[model samples]
Target: MDDLFAPSDVSWTPVSPKLAAVRRVNAAIIFGVLAIVALIALGMSLGWTYGVLGLLVVAGGFAWAWVLIGRNQRSWKYAEREDELLVSHGIMFRQLVVVPYGRMQFVDVAAGPLERAFGIATVELHTATPATDAKIPGLHPDEASRLRDRLSALGQAQAWGL
Candidate 1:
């Protein structure tokens, strides 16, 4: 099954490790809010004991997600081929997307507030078919820009049959 998604000959490029850190921070913020809410709500409705228990459960969930975020981030990789680009990720339900240069209508590089704070960007490829479009996240800004330009040039060249 792994062999089916990942080719042995291709040299895969991994996203920045900062992705895991950013994800962990995001998870922490979410879980922290949940914990506070749970503690307050449960404590008021039930008892302080139940509130602490709820907070514990939320903490456990965050711990599990923290591990998963690292694994998931490590799994993300993209490889550029002669004619197409391959992006693959996911630990359990893996997905591999192949986007042909000729099929790409546009490429986008974007960085949200958090992503910009972390100095990372996402590169999205748009095709005529929405289902064929794909995005790679956690790339450095420079790499994202270079990829966007390169992909645009490649797509144009392929479209022109040059």
Candidate 2:
């Protein structure tokens, strides 16, 4: 039987670990909001009992979210083949998207404020149809640009309509 858990023949390139930093930043924001809410509720005479319990639950959830985010970042990967590019992610659901070079219309590299601050970028692949487009996130800026250019060149050279 084929190995169900093993990766395929194509060698996948894993995303930058710096993505965890972005996720941590987002988790920090959520915890901050929760803290403010708890403070407001306590200040409004909502009783220290409920306020403290709510804070504890929210704190636990925040910790769990960090674990999930770390797993997700570790799972995210992409590979380029002779005919197509593959993007795969998800710790449980296992999503894999294949964007044929021939169907690719363009590729873009983008970084948001947090991503830029972390020196990482995301590459978006646009196929002839919106349904086939995909994104690979958390790559170093230089790698993202290189991937964007390579995909663009390959797409132009081998473009075949969907």
Candidate 3:
């Protein structure tokens, strides 16, 4: 099953471990807030029984969702080829994106509040068209900057069609 997205034919660079923690914490926080709201609503409208049951269901669902989020985050990977960059993700429904250097107009690396809290960043590649753009997320801050620089250099060096 792993071979479907990550084959031995090419190297795969895994996302940072901090990404899993960030994802887990984010999921927990979101579900925690929703669970609180549900408990209040159900308890007031129906009774304590419905509130308790709803809380338990929300907790269980949060656990399951956290597990799935971790799995999905771990499944993400990116690789750089001579002429293009390869990004692959997903456990069941796999997606592979190839961004050619010749098509790349610019490269950018950014980090949001959540990602900054975890010391991770994302690198986005902008091609001639938005449809062909590719993004690699959950990379270490330094790694993301290095990738941005490398891709920019490669894009310039390979800009024969541009």
Cα TM-score per model:
0.97, 0.91, 0.92
The Cα RMSD of model 1 versus the native structure comes to 1.2
lDDT of 2 by residue, 1-162 (tens): 222332478898999999988988989898979977986687467777778877887888889988988998998988889988988888788777888898887788889999999999999999778988999999998899899999998898887443
Q: Which has the higher lDDT value, candidate number 1 or candidate number 2?
A: 1
Q: Report the lDDT tens digits of candidate 3 across residue range 22-114.
A: 888888998899899889999999997898889999999998998898899887899888888989988878888888988899998988899
Instruction: List the global CA lDDT of all models.
Output: 0.96, 0.85, 0.88
Residue pairs with backbone overlap in model 2: none
Put the candidates in TM-score order, highest first: 1, 3, 2
Clashing pairs in 1: none
Residue 59 lDDT in model 3? 96
The best candidate in terms of TM-score: 1
Displacement of residue 145 (Cα, Å) in model 3 is 0.5
Q: What residue runs in model 1 are displaced by over 4 Å at the alpha carbon? A: none
- Judging by lDDT, tell me the better candidate of 1 and 3: 1
Task: Please list the residue runs of candidate 3 whose C-alpha ends up more than 4 Å from where it truly belongs after superposition.
Answer: 1-7
